[model samples]
Target chain A: MAAGNEEISLPASARRLLPPFAAAPFGPLLTLSLRSLARRRPGLFERLGEHSTARFLIDPTDLSFAFSVVPDGASAVVRVTGKSGSAPSDVVIRGPLLTLLGVLDGTLDGDAMFFHRAIAVTGKTEAVVALRNAIEDAELRPSDLLGLRGVLARLADAGILGGLSAARHFAADAPVAKAGQA
Target chain B: MSGRMELVCPAGTPATLRAAVLAGADAVYCGFRDETNARNFPGLNFSPQEMAEGIRFAHGNGSKALVAINTFARAENTDLWRKAADTAAVCGADAVIAADIAVLDHMANNHPRTRLHLSVQAAAATPEAISFYAQAFGVRRVVLPRVLSVQEIAVLNRAIDVETEAFVFGGLCVMMEGRCHLSSYATGKSPNLNGVCSPPEAVSYVEDAEGTTARLAGFTIDRFGAGEPAGYPTLCKGRFTAGDKTGYLFEDPVSLNAGSMIVALKSAGVTALKIEGRQRGKGYVTEVVRAFRRAVDAAESGGDPVEIDGILAGLSEGGRQTTGAYRKTWR
Candidate 1:
């Protein structure tokens, strides 16, 4: 398991290319979130194995957050976590934080929450919301970020984003959009 | 296409069951008035005696009765579902409609001779998912999700072995059935487990300073003027705000009327046309079933589909009807 406190120095070129926020808050946030997530290495691995099935997990460390997709019957786990502050050595997140992470990842939707109410946070609602927004902004595709490289191969014929953007656009406006726009 | 497509109808009570069968339903589906079925309303569904009698009555009239045991079974309380399966099998129903995997396994294991139809509550929208169920549990027919177009249905028909049943009229569900969690969020009970969504107990209507807002479990679903008809309070049809806009984000309050698409459905290889209003009165059931029976018979006899435009207009929800997902152009 990767330790959060492990010093990872970026290349000089990478540092220069990073946005100011990425260096200041975003970098630390990502590092902390990753390290915290890594602390739950076994659970994260378990979730990753079941990504195609229905099980989900959310991990929120002190400075960052993460989620894992565990396959239903598989032995392996796949995890994806991100944060907004300095990376820590070890971290733990509440169950609610884990569920919210699944929602932002698009693995879960509003209707799912509306129906199940699977995740509920107790302490800091705004922090969870912020974490959700940051993860959405990151736009990390599960196939790419997670070690589901073979899953991406199956979907390769469908194109890079697999018509996600077009579908979103269509869902937002659809047939009524043209008439409404006029 | 071939013969007249079967008009499969819903009957919440024995009265409605008899009415639908006599009015022209080739088949009627009902459930035990318990949590085992989706329409677990207070007065709806059948008693075991009613179910046995309903089956005998339908059979005597050359019609079939299907028992719906469609609710998802809890992990520990599998006995309730097993008992429902046993009762349906004992009642001599033509088929038992089920959704839960464990329940399906139970039926297959216990009553291997009994026919199983996949309930719409399974939400098996894709061919792969549907095939998975059919292969696993010997599901003879699948009541497909309402999301597919006629073309999609045709394509699926070519791939799967089982017959397909589809909604041709009555209430419209905006999201996938069985998978919906909206009702559970507002109220603790859900369709998957409790077999009721937006239950009457949790629904309330109040005329406030703004308007008459229909609420489900205290959350506003829709608001109507004094003159406008207030629709049922379901979580999906509720008016809510998302980024400042406040309106129906899921679907407008409307019933489905596929009267004009009888020919298209026949061409698409749909074996059964389902009418969905178990909570309605016998008159509504008789009228709708009779109209559809006439339409289907006419179309089968190489005649044009019968038109009951004015009669049906009065029965529609809010006096509005949509073709729903049948016509791809709606998407």
Candidate 2:
């Protein structure tokens, strides 16, 4: 598990009832997904490699983890980096996991997110642009990961989905309940 | 009253351009891949080939494609703007939307036949500025800034010889289009130059046991409580600590949705209703353009405006909508 991962408010029910499981590192997960994608779309990786002239470091702010992504031949490689506070990179993207998922899913507007400051980029702007363009062109998603659904199903069987709903309800009601009490 | 007002929509990619055209957008505006246009975001806009293809697709669908080379050109990089204008003209763009004086001059001198429209980034709110652009660069229309009211727009239209476009929907820029520099103050890049505001790379959202706080360049812009929906940390829309209160000082985190005022806006002499959000996707372009098309047709035929209300709520920012400065109460 990523360091400081416990601090992030996962859906409320999950926090109360679910026990933490050992999650895999983000790098291996990303790499496996990218390799599968490259195999499916050979030209896409080449185009991405051409555009990704600089390296990128993605930081999930809620977790104590970061990743370095660089183009290698026709495919890109992702490696687990330690943290944002120490690692130096050409471009750095820091945001919440939900926002990252939203971007990958194409449901969230990256520009609007930037405008809102939910996602941030620092270092060379060109590198971030290249990465963004490549990602959008490739249209990768968290669901695109191999066997992700199976993993999710196992988690759901553990009452993860119910926990999420309970957390959401708790979050939605806490403020109103406090006001009512006051 | 005899003619229907043009419904101009935004197109970030060729797919969205095609979607807008099919959805009944009379004209679609897009920018080049670089910082030449205001909506310079990652994975958005078009390349030269994509622009040509987009133009072809739009024209085939009986719609026009307007290329936006709207950003201000640096003295050293004047050729980049010139090349973009040249490309737009060659690509058969119906119009080239520009804000810079130099870029306009280049378009006027070289591609005299290609129509020119003054960008809202110019912040040309008065007849004098509009007339100046019209006379100097043969500008056919002006995309008026967000500052003017419907009544003021009607008055200005009577004075200016050129056509006027007003924003009817999408994201709201609380500051004047071209003048705001809050992003530059925090990030090193300005919208006028880099074509980004509160750029993504400079933003970070910190979540803890208490809540989530949105930060821009290390400065905390807004803090969200446990259940509150955290919005983007745009400088203008940020909550700040005042003497005794802490709240949004400049603007709220809501989208502009003026579907209800289509008739009043048309009556105010607005020639066109421009929908912003060039950085949006085909789904957004299709939904917004289709709804606005129905709304415009309805308004022109003296029908109800509420027809589009329900369709737009899901797309609004933070699920909240406003008429913005168009309504006097918003002032």
Candidate 3:
């Protein structure tokens, strides 16, 4: 077991709950993130062809990559290499992409993947807008494994999602509770 | 034996651009409305057409216009940045202020005649890094990061061939520019790449049964009581619990007020003094530029440092100020 695992375990009720799509270890999230990437691959290829100088250096397994886009938000170059070796071929991506590959590949967290740095960019500023629009437009919602309304709804039902709420309530109500007793 | 230091001023609009020029700014820096500049806030910065007009107006008054295209360029979007650079060149800008290495490389290669001023966003705080940019891209000037003291500035000025610009007054950024990840941790955007830090979009205020708290990207950064003045929610200035103490760990919400340090800065051999705040209004631009202009003029005339206390008190952040790293204070 990991160092902290001994301190915590799934409650009997929580254990009976089905894992969400992304919470089922890495398998489903990886597949979903990859599927999202594959869906956008055609657009990526078209964007890559538009820029002569743009290139991407990605470590899909490690989630580190460098990419360059053309001056116009039309084409890009992406290289995803292994830790020790060069990339296979400088893959191309279209302008303004969310680039789910990093999150799927476990190189980046969900937040970082959605945020700016996960998709390291160099070149034009409009490409950022385009990329943001594309990703947001995709609305890559995390899968609802048990067909719950949403990720939050499922997590709330599972009883594991309220740690922050408990922590916040404890921090806020501790003093109030003490005063009430006094 | 120090050469006459240049005094750079900010101009948010064309009128302020004229005000800065008429007030005796050696050069005026402004940015286009898009993400090309660090001050990407709405209602601030000039449109491309306005930038052309501002550049013309400044040049007409015998002052130079330095276009700030300092934000880090996004990958696969090089065209916008390239066009920004090209536009500045065509608009007769005296120089292009940039922070990214790739942007510098592009400018140096494509527009060889256009002067390049390295923005503070590069965080080239060390002599070696400044020297490296100078050697690599022939950068004419480097806007030194806000982490250096007067003595350090003198030492750095000696080591590098490029001219150095140091902030004299206005907002203070505690973290090393171009190096901080705190903003990215909270907001998806960062100043280095996105030209914004602790962006307004990611901020929220929650007044619960306990107290009023400011949250950034769902993390409670600061909490305020009813009487205390609530400040803009920046990650560094926010109150947080680190260990037993729940207070500002990084820095207080204070603007940098360096009006009293003009003599030290002049003696330190800084080539230019930059005033930060491009989001400020025209009145702010007028007052600050006027005050600094008087101080610089007084210093040049061998007069006592001009008193500019009343002029800029209204424009300070949280109505509080500090000399920042210029004075070595433990707190």
Candidate 4:
């Protein structure tokens, strides 16, 4: 398990209910996902243009661990760590796990999320914008990360669907942010 | 009796166009992918094929599409602007909004049948200037610049022959329409020239204990305290020090929410009420258009003004609302 995960105000009933799964290493799956996406859309990272060299810290606030992704086309790897893991990423995108997933999968608007304060970002706005543009164009779904058709894909998909209610589960316990609250 | 104001909305993409139509816009305006139209962000505009499809969608849903061929034509690339105008005409755009004299001349001489609306980028604030466009090019309507007060617009409307459109909501530029040099000075790309003020590539936010610092092209624009609503540091909204005091020297980082002035604007003989932010997402487009739809309807039916100052609170940059120059004459 990652150390020093930022403590959000989720209720005891919803917090860390997926103890075993939360402990499961997500780096390999994320790495696989990025590789699959790069393979399917060759120009995905190239669209990042000058921002290709920047490292991104993707923080899923509902989860215990965060991820650092160094996007370099097919060779990209995702490192799962705590919020305080890195010194300086080109950008830091923090939000509920499912919403972040939704943004990546093009199911949600990152701008709307940012506007609603559902997402908090710091660091290079250009890199964040580039990532958003690249992700929107690539049109990758969460299940696309697996690239499998058998039982493993089914299991991953089930987990992905279950993650939605679980995200709301965490959110329901947290204090509601006010209108235009940052 | 006051005539019902036409609701003009912005659509950056085809999905947004459909959203605006479904939500309640009488018209939606968009741009081509090239710089011939403004709001030329990467992956944000429509192509010729997409424009044709979007226009068809708007028309099918009882909405009109206004193609923005608004950017001034480069001396060497005048044909590019003409081609965009040609594509807009070919696609059967309800109107082509243009600013440059060459473009207006091209539209008048070449596509004589197509309707012409003067873009706010033209900054034709006077009856004389507006009369020149109306008489010379047969421009049917002119989008008034944001610099005018509601009273000034009321007075100007009676003197001009053409219809007038006024901005009701969304982003505000303190500059004279798109005539901004600060963006060019900082990033070397003017909204007038390149269609992007504080171009995304030139923007960055750095977070330390001092809080978030918004920068434009490596120059510090502003800093926000922890948990403060951070705003994009456009040159106009950035706080600066003048004469030993630090503050928003030009204007504060607040969005224009002119809902209260809807009835007043209608009384001022405004033909259309516009919502800005073509580069906004479908969700943004949907919510704002719907809220203003009710507001506009209320103004028509003699109901409440919809008190929309707080409706757009979450979506607005800096999370603050203002009546803007519509009420207060900053000049």
Rate residue A16 of model 4 by lDDT. Answer: 40
Q: Relative to the unseen true structure, what is the C-alpha lDDT of residue A29 in candidate 4, on a scale of 0 to 100?
A: 78
* Candidate 1 residue-wise lDDT, B31-133, digit = tens: 9868999987654677788799999999999999999999999887888888899999999989899999988998898888888999999999788998999
Clashing residue pairs in candidate 4, if any? none
- Model 1's DockQ? 0.01
DockQ of 2: 0.13
Q: Tell me how much of the true interface, by contacts, candidate 3 captures.
A: 0.00
**By descending lDDT, how would the candidates be arranged?**
4, 2, 1, 3
- The TM-score ranking, best first, is 4, 2, 1, 3
Better candidate by TM-score, 3 or 4: 4
In model 3, the runs with Cα more than 4 Å from the true position are: A1-182, B206-212, B242-244
Query: Candidate 2, residues A23-74: lDDT per residue as tens digits?
Result: 2365677777777766666645433434455677777654445678775533
Task: Place model 4 in a CAPRI quality band.
Answer: acceptable
TM-score of each: 0.63, 0.75, 0.62, 0.83
Q: By DockQ, highest first, what's the ranking?
A: 4, 2, 3, 1
Instruction: Please give the TM-score that candidate 3 achieves against the real structure.
Output: 0.62
lDDT of every model, 2 decimals: 0.66, 0.73, 0.62, 0.78
Which DockQ-derived CAPRI band holds candidate 1?
A: incorrect
| TM-score, chain B, predicted structure 2 | 0.96
Off by over 4 Å in 2: A1-33, A36-73, A77-182
A1-182: candidate 1 lDDT, tens digit per residue = 00110111222332234333333453344434444444433323221221223323344321223444332222324345443122231112232322333344443331123222232222222222323322322333534333345757447524534454343333323322111112
lDDT of candidate 3 over A76-125, digit per residue (tens): 22222233134332232321112233222222222222121222222232
